[model samples]
Target: MEEKSGDSLATVLVAGAANLTIALAKLVAGLIGGSAAMLSEAAHSAADTVTELLLLVSVRRSGKPPDERHPFGYGKAGFFWAMMAAVATLVGGAGFSVTHGVHEISHGEELGNLTPSYVVLAVSFVIEGVSLSKALSQLRAAAGRHRIRPLRLVRITSDTALKAVLFEDAAALVGLVIAAIGLLGSQWSGSALWDGAASVAIGLLLLVVALILIQSNLSLLIGQAAPRQVETGIRAVLLAQPEVEEVVELLTMMIGPGSIMVAAKIDFCDEAGAAGVEIACDEVDRRLRDRFPGVNLVFLDPTPTRRS
Candidate 1:
C-alpha cells in the first residue's frame, strides 16, 4: 500500500509540472492567435494543474496511519479530495470553455496569426502524452498484480488519484487534437465558427470525465463494497476453518484504499466448545490477514444455524 501511494505521488507530480508548463504556453498562444479553442485549452490545462495539486494532497493525507480520532485511518481522504478536484475541472474547465465558446460563436473575433497556436498544440500533446504514459505505466503494473486488464482495473480500482490523473491526461491529449483541428478549420474557412464549436466539444468532453471521477469518488466515500473477487476469497477463507460449520451472512466495506473491513456470522460445529470457537477465531483472523493484507479488520459472531 505504501508503495502504491508513493507511485501515485510521483505520477501526480509529473502531471502537475507538465500541466503548469502547458497552461502557460497555451495561454500565450491563445492570445497571440486569438483562437477561442486555444484559450479553452488553456483553461483545461489550468484546471488539470489544480486537480493534480489536490491529488497530491489526497495521496499524502490518505497515507497517514490510523489515529485515535480516526480508527479507520485517513484512506478515504483521497476520495474526498479527488472528488473536489473533479469539481474544479467541472467549474474551471468545462464551465469556462462552454460559456466562452457560445459567446464566441455569437460574437466572433477576426482570426489572427494562428501559427503559434498550432505549434503550442503540437507541443502540448507531446507533454500530455508523456504524463499519460507515466500513469499508464503505474496502471499496467497494478493491473498485472491483480491479474486483470488495465481498462477493467481503472473502472473498479479505488485508487482515485491514479484514476484522476489517467483520465485528465488522456483528456488533455484529446483536447489538444481538437484545438489543432479547430485552428485548421478556422484558418481554412476564414471564420471562427469551427474554433467555437471545437471549444464546446472540448468542454463537453471534460464534463463527462469530471462526472465520471466524481461518481467514482462519491461511491467509494459512501462505503462501497469491496470487489466481488475479494469478498468471495474472504468467504472461502472463513469456511476453510474446521470449526466453522456455515457462513450465515457476510458483509464487507471498502474502508480505505487497499483496505477492507469484513464482518460475518458463522455457525460453528456442534462438537466445537467455546474454547474451540475461540481458537478458531484466532486462527481465522491470522489467516485472513496473511492471505489478504488489505483485509485489515474482521469480526466474526458465532450463531446457531437456521433451518427451514
Candidate 2:
C-alpha cells in the first residue's frame, strides 16, 4: 500500500510540473497570437495545473499513519481533494473556456500571427504526452500485479489521484489538437468562427471528464464496496478454514486507495471449543492478510447457524 501511495505521488508530481510549464506557454502564445482557441486551451492547462496541486495535497494528507483520533487514518482525504480538483476543472477550465468561446463567437475578434500558437501547441502535446505516459505506466504496473486489463482496472480502481491525472493528461492532449485545428481553420478561412467553435468543443470535452471524475471521487467518499471478485476471494478464504461451518455474511469496503476493510459473521463447528475458535480467528486474520495485502482491517463475528 505504501508503495502504491509512493507511485501515485510520483505520478501526480510529474503531471503537475508538465501542466505548469504548458499553462505558461499556452498563456503566452494565446496573448501573442490573439487566438481564442489558444486562450481557452491556456485556461484548460491552468485548471489542470490547479488540479494537480490539489491532488498533491490529497496524496500527502491521505498517507498519514492512523492515529487514535482517526483510527482509519486520513485516507478519504484523497477522494475529497480529488473531487475538489474536478470542481476546479469544471469551474476554472470548462466554464471559462465555454463562456469565452461563446463571447468570441458572438463578437468576433481579429487574430494576429498564429505561428507562435502552432509552435506552442506542438510542444504542449509532446509534454502532455510524457505526463500521460507516466500515469499509464503506473496504471499498467498495478494492473499487471492484479492480473487484469489496464482499462478494467482503471474503472474499478479507487485511486482517484491516478485516475484524475490520467484523464486530465488525455484531455490536455486532445485539447491541444483542437486548438491547433482552430488556429488553422481561422487562418485558412479568415474567419473567427472556426476558432470559436473549437474552443467550445474543448470546453465540452473538459466538462465531460470533470463530471466523470467528480462522480468517481464522490462514490469513494461515500464508502464504496470493494470489487465483487475481491469479496468472493475473501469469502472463499474464510470458508476454507476447517473450523468454520459457514460464512453467514461478509462485507467489504474500500477504506482508501489500496486499502480495504472486511467484516464477516462466521458459524463455527459444534466440536470447536472457545479456544479453538479464538485460534481459528487469529489464523483467519493471518491467512486473509497474506492473501490480500490490501485487507488492512478485518472483523470476524461468530454467529449460530440458522435452522433450515
Candidate 3:
C-alpha cells in the first residue's frame, strides 16, 4: 500500500507540473500564432492541471484510516474524483476545443507565427512524454507482480489516479503531434481550414478517452468483483485446510487496489456439533489470513452437509 501510494503521488505531481507548463506555453503561443488548435491545446492542458490536483487530493483522502462514517474506508473517494475528472475533461477541454474549432471554420481566418507554435508544441510533447514515462514505470512494476498486461491492470486496479494521469498524458502527447501535423499542412498548403479540422480531431480524441475513464471509474465505484482466478485460488487455499471439507460458496469484491474482502460458506467434516463447527470456522479464517495477506476481511460461515 505504501509503495502504491508513493507511486500515485509521484505520478500526480509529474502530471500537474507538465500540465502547468504546457497550459502557460500554449496560451502564449496560441495568442501569438492566432491558431485555434494552439488555443484548444491550452484549454486541454489547463483542464488536465485541475484534474491532476483533484486526483492528488483524492489519493490522500482515500489513504485515510477507516472512520465511523465510512466502514469501507475512503477508498472510493479516488474513484469518485476520477469520474469527475473525466467529466471535466469532456466539458472544459473537449467542449472548448470543439467550439473554437467550429468558430475558426466558419470565420476562415488566416493563422500567423507558425514557428513559435511548433516550438511550444514540441516542448509540450517532451514534457508529456516524461510524465507518461513516470506513470508507465509505476504501472509496469505493479502489473508485473500481478502477471497481467498494463492495459488490463489499469482497467481493474484500484490505482485510478495513476491510470487517469497516464491516459491524459498519452492523449496530450498524441494531440500535440496531431496539431503540429495540421499546422504544417496548413502552412504548406496555405489553408487555415486544416488547422481547425485538427482541433476538432483532438477534441474527439479527448472525448473518447474521457468516456473510457468515466466508465472505468464508475465500475470501480459500483463495487467490481475480484478476478475469477484470484477468487478460485483463494477457495482452493481454504479447502486445502484439514478442518474445511469444502467451500460451498465464495464471493469476493475488491475494496481497494490489491485489497479484497471475501464472504464464504464452508462445510466442515472434521467436527460434528455446532461448537465444533464454530471452532473449525475460526481455524479456517486464521489459515486464510495467513495464506492471503491481501484479504483484509474474511467472513466464513460453517454449514453442515447432509453427508457430514
Residue lDDT tens for model 2, 81-155: 999999999999999999999988999888998888888999998999999999999999999888888998889
Whole-model Cα lDDT of every candidate shown, in order:
0.91, 0.91, 0.83
The candidate, 1 or 2, that scores higher on TM-score is 2
Clash pairs, model 3 backbone = none
How many clashing residue pairs, candidate 2? 0
Rank candidates, lDDT, best first: 2, 1, 3
- What is the per-residue lDDT of model 3 for residues 83-126, given as tens digits with 9 covering 90 to 100? 89889899988999888988888886788888889899988888
> What TM-score does model 1 achieve against the real structure?
0.96
Please identify model 3 stretches exceeding 4 Å from their true place: 1-3, 270-293, 305-308
Error of 2 at 230 (Å): 0.6
Q: What is residue 207's positional error in candidate 2, in angstroms?
A: 0.6
Return the clash pairs for model 1, or none: none
Best by TM-score: 2
